[model samples]
Target: MTFTDILREENDDVFQKIFSHPFVQGIGKGDVPKEALAHYIKADYEYLNAFMHIYGAAISKSGSREDIQYFNNQIDFVLNSEIHPHNNFCKHIGASYEELQGYPLPPTADHYVKHMMYHAHMGGLGEITGALLPCPWTYLEIGKELVKLYKPTVNHPFYHWITFYANEQVEETTLQMRKRLDDLASKASEKELEQMKIAFRKSCQLELAFWEMAYTCEEWPVRDYVKV
Candidate 1:
């Protein structure tokens, strides 16, 4: 099986949890609290900023013009298509980007983004792709599946969020990234392949935690007890 297939099979439990998680199910039912979305939107903006940086890092680290070109395209997609909509979500939710950025990263969010950064800084193409792959790919899967279950109307609270990831643009980008990972895997050493598998599995775990964080509007558990 392919690395992603193997990784997904191994972490199938996490994937199932993510899809069934209350936060995601909330979107399906149009009953999700706005407060939860408020917390999520803020942290998500921060996450997107990190994602953009990793894409830029991927460009500089890329060995070929084709890879650099793809990274440039991905960055453009994030900025032009994705980020603007995120800002709109912030506006609708009434969370200022300034406020969100200034807030400390929640623990799950911190671990997830930091892992992507670590691989972007340390790993080559396949490893970085493995680290980055879980977000868009899994979201697209969830989004597509959610839309089917919810059949959300135009006015649904999370309709835009649902449709955005469920649509062709995200699907196209995800497949391209997977194809890139496959190509990288073809030439990678067995040790490198193992690292990629590790990255993919850990990333899947983080994705599940991200949803749990959203459901609870999680902050660092120890924040209230600080000695300072």
Candidate 2:
């Protein structure tokens, strides 16, 4: 099976569990608490900011000159145009470009970021591509369900914000990752290629767990804006 197919099948299992949860199901349906939603909004922005930085680092370290340029251009656009602007959910949550500088990301967030950097710094280009694909790709999968279940409305900034990353950006990134993977896989050692597949799958599971933790928690300082 193709990398995209493998990722989709693995993500489907995790997305179902997250979407089936009461907290996730309630979002955008008027059941979520405003405070919880607010927290999520802020956290999501912080997360995105960190994500851009980490991915930028990976792009910088890529072996392929083209990969480096692609990631750099994408990162520049996201930081300057897409994410920097104080509009939409970022505006509603008071997450300005300046505030993003001081935002404190979750520890687990660092794990993913650092992991990508490590692979990019030490591993082949294909390995770095594999490492980066799971998170955005999984988010895209979940975002589709959220859109389906909780049609976007003015009141639901949280869902709307996430949908942007999941729909528009993730597809483009996934396509780039597939191209990188295919190109590198030919030169990659058999063991290294297998490891990349395993790492991608494990990362997908972690993404699911992160959502499950957010939904199952009783009190989240960051997600308090959304009422459970």
Candidate 3:
């Protein structure tokens, strides 16, 4: 089996939790509290900003024009394509995507982005891809699964969000990233491959935590203790 297949099999439990999370299920039923959706929109907007930076880091670490262009295209997709769903959801929730940009990254999101940044700064392309792969890939999995389970109609509150991630474009990008990682793994030393595995697993854990964070609207504990 391919390395990604291995990772997926191992991380199936976590992915299952993510799929069953209230936040995701709410999206399916179109009944999630607007506040929860607002929290997710704000936090995810910040998270995607950091996500794009990792792509930039990957471009810097790339040794080939092909790799650079791939990251560039992903950056464009994030900016132009991926966020359209966010914008649409924002309109429905009566929030401005532009205003959400200034909201602080929630604690879980901060930790998640730092995890990716650590790998991006300290490792090569393989490590960067390893850390980066979970975001899009897992969302694609969730999107596809949601569609299969819920059969969300066009009138579903998050129909665009669900369909956006489940679409061919997302699957294509995910497969391309997987192909890139598999290519990198083909030449990697065992030690390097193990590090990539570690990165992949940890990122999967973080992805699950991200859904929990959205469901809870997680905030810093310090904020509770230290009143302004």
TM-score of each predicted structure versus truth: 0.90, 0.70, 0.95
Q: Of the pair 1 and 3, which is ahead by TM-score?
A: 3
lDDT, candidate 1, 47-84, per-residue tens: 87788899988998888898899998988888788864
User: What's the count of clashing pairs in each model shown?
Assistant: 0, 15, 0
Model 3: residues >4 Å from true position, as ranges?
A: 224-228
Query: Per-residue lDDT tens digits of candidate 2, residues 61-103?
Result: 6767877788786577556655522255445555454543443
lDDT of 3 by residue, 123-211 (tens): 88999999999888999988999899999998888899999999999999999999999999989999889889888988989998988
Alpha carbon deviation, residue 6, candidate 1 (Å): 2.9
Ranking by lDDT: 3, 1, 2
Model 1 CA RMSD to the hidden true structure, in angstroms: 2.7
lDDT of each: 0.83, 0.60, 0.88
Worst 10 residues of 1 by lDDT: 83-92
